[model samples]
Target: MDTKLLQEIEKGTKSALIKKNIINYYIQSGSSTITELSKVLDLSIPTVTKLIAEMCDDGYIEDKGKLETSGGRHPSLYGLNPESGFFIGVDIKHFRVHIGIMNFKGDLIDEDLIPYSIENSPESLDHLCKIILSFIHKQNIKQDKILNININISGRVNPESGYSYSIFYFEERPLSEIISSKIGYRVTIDNDTRSMTYGEYLAGCVNNEKNIIFVNVSWGLAIGIIIDGKIYSGKSGFSGEFGHIQAFDNEILCHCGKKGCLETEASGAAIYRHLKQAIKDGASSILSKKILEGKHITLQDIIEATNKEDILCIELVERTGLELGKHIAGLINIFNPEMVIIGGTVSLTADYIMQPIKTAIRKYSLNLVNKDSKIVLSNLRDRGGMIGACLLARTRLFEI
Candidate 1:
């Protein structure tokens, strides 16, 4: 949020805090009658009634129709105004960006993708800012109506301090602050994997499953954790760096400059590397001809071949899934979560990716612990990060 806004919120009194509570309540419960809200918020009826009037006058909330009552007078419902504010959620990849806008009610209103390549440099950072502003202009969204811009980026990001350790590193100011200056809007940045996890938790399947783990098997690998029904960002918001854990004894270097990391053997990068090598070793498959020609291979191409029953592709995919599951089984032993969600580009392979992971879990994890957790694929799939960023923007807005 802006500095002035933060100052106001911090200096505000008890009534201000209660107003925040009311906004958060509507966000969580959709809509509620004054009587219901008073009971839930532990406030007097007159107090809630007055606050409701103030919020309505301030254009933050609105009065919906009354709820039907059998005998006594029907109670009117108050809820957030859907158009009171808007949020921009950006999912940034190395070479792609997904931009979307969401209403205050957490509904995605518009989404678009841009082929914007980003590297760890000042120029790339400025390029991202231009793209965001351009998107807003193209959509004709008023700057005043936009509440904040929330970005989901891959790598080591400490969301609390708004500093990104992996990309656009700076010494003086946090990345979010830098971007905010360029775009003239409040900016919030978080780990992409964590945002994807939140997206699935809020909008995907697995209804009300509190303790959860969302495994993102993309070009690289990472995880998002939900503990006690809240997104678990550890000391520096780096709690779910699942891919960097050492799981093998090898010399292959990972993107993080470490050897023997799980990412070196089980990520989308692993599948691509293994598939290409297998094809070079006289393995016959749909991707073999492309491999023989020394053409670039993408994870999507490999997944398509696997879905078409290519033997080499299938083996490579299953190997990745099996390795992922073996490691995930250890997590089950530790966390005993209620659900584990598999997501990202690799998940598009569907059964080719899921079956092997399921097998490894059944064979490796304790039956008792594994039984408490149901492992499944993400319902949001490729859209998780984008949608999650939008939801993140909405939820963080009321944190003041």
Candidate 2:
């Protein structure tokens, strides 16, 4: 074997790798004693102590008092100083963008929401860059302290090359490189669904689950698959296009240029469109009154109406939920995931949606698969994508 290949196999010098691992372990575990670090890193006590001393001197890690030992002297606990670094996580949607600034411990320090539509053109790119720069400037933090920027957007993203095939049309440059060059910080981009799934896996309800599926039910539906304890982005990093899966044989066209896709009948956009059509057809409901008052019915309006037990809204939500559940049942039969996390804005209507989804899953999925899979609402809610983006940035920059 070549010497270069051997070096690659070793990752780096032993000391450098050990230091990196130590930092990552401290970040993940919150704090660690010298003996604990030594055991986890499989290094000598003296070696671990030396590296910890160096890190403490360099202002990376700090002694966080001591941990009570069973018998001997108390062991000093070392943790990453919260001020050591910062990360920015951006969650982009078609009509809005959410930016979160997180500390080294992954706690969100600050956040900003920009209500702006992102167009699929260069002008939009310039506007996005400006928005990001403005947000960072307003945080009153040094640019160097902001270590990494993780961006999560809804689309088919090629993680390796940072090419977003679903959104920007800049054929000549990768989106990550373009954003990084303009923002003056390293950037990493991922699909919004995948990022949310990763966030759940890291800190939400799906923590430590080896096999899990996160279904994001928003304006559109998307799935994030975790197999064997890692995100499965498939060959092109576009694995979870669950929204586009065929759910009906009807002629309703989808944004993906297909007819009868799951999103066509089961997404928030679909529910809104269907409600509008029903009102136009003289359907009697409270939403119709809102329509008469020249107010457009949004997904939120429908959810509110459903809570009020308005027949039309209740029917619409249940129908959409059933359609979504059918697709989810198919997924359960295939993946046999330990957990199915339902997230996104639409998930807020948990009372109206969960039961229908459960009904459909029971009806369509095999007994064994349906019984084993636990479908639950996401705890992180809207923050999952942004949190996941921050985690992505940390993992990429720190190789954690």
Candidate 3:
């Protein structure tokens, strides 16, 4: 190897070692006092103190406050500084953008929403950029202080470059660069479902659990696989594209230009669409009048209908649940994850959804895996996307 290459390699090794110790200290104690970190990292007090002082000077950590002392004086507590830097997480949905901010410890500081239609044209990108800039300005956070930005989009994101083959009609641009240019931060973009899984592992459902799967069942179905507390984006970062999985022999067209996809029959958007058609076909539902009034139908509507014992609505939700359950069963057989965290708008009706999913897993998945695996709704619910984006911002970049 070249002499310069050798020197650069050595520098890289030292940088990793330093970052590793800092990350280890943060992970072990959640937040660490400088003295505690120095001792834990096994360096001499003075040397450790110097390193910490440098870190503080670099805005990686800060002196939070003093701990109360019984005698003499109080000891200052040093921790990963919340204000030293910020991260932005944006979940780009079919209808809305859910954005949130997080500090180093993955604590959500604030969130906002912006709605837009999925026309997928040049105008849509302009609209998205405007919404993001407006949100950043409204928060009053310094753009320079923003270290990382994570964006989740609804289509396949080329993991190597952050380019997307989109369903919506927008100018094709690398999402990471687009956001980075506007926000002046290092931006990471991934598939929405993968981000949800990453979020569950970092803050919500699978925080302590090592093996978990986050299933996103909204306008489309997607899976986020966490194996041993890490998001498992297999070859091409498209490993968990669950929506296109064949679920029926029926001739229903799917968004992916396929037929009989699980998403066509079971996703929240499907439920809303199915209910509208059912009512038009003289199906009896209390929601019928609401639909006639031009009220927007959501997953909540079907759930509420089930609560009121509306036969058609109940059947609709139950059937969707049954299809979802079968798909989950296939996941259980393949991944054998310890927990299956169901997320998305549809998961608000977890009680009704879980029944059929559980039944299907018991019927189709291998007994060995299904016996210990659990299927539950995400604790974060609506917050998974944003929280996941926050965690995604925190993730160390993988080098090939």
Better of 2 and 3 by TM-score: 2
For model 3, the run of ten residues with the poorest summed lDDT: 1-10
- Candidate 2's displacement at residue 109, Å, is 0.5
lDDT tens per residue, model 3, 163-218: 77764324466767776676566778888888887777766755467888888887
Using alpha carbons, what is the TM-score of model 3?
0.85
In candidate 2, clashing pairs total: 0
Compute the lDDT for candidate 3. 0.74
lDDT accuracy of residue 260 in candidate 3: 88
Candidate 3 regions off by >4 Å? 1-13, 24-29, 33-49, 63-78, 167-173, 182-184, 290-311, 396-400
Task: Give the CA lDDT, 0 to 100, for residue 320 in model 2.
Answer: 83
Writing each residue's lDDT as its tens digit, candidate 2 over 282-363 gives 8978888778677845566777787888898888889988988988999999999999998886787776888899899999
TM-score for all models, in order of appearance: 0.95, 0.90, 0.85
Candidate closer to the true structure by TM-score (higher is better), 1 or 2: 1
| lDDT over C-alpha atoms for residue 306 of model 3 | 75
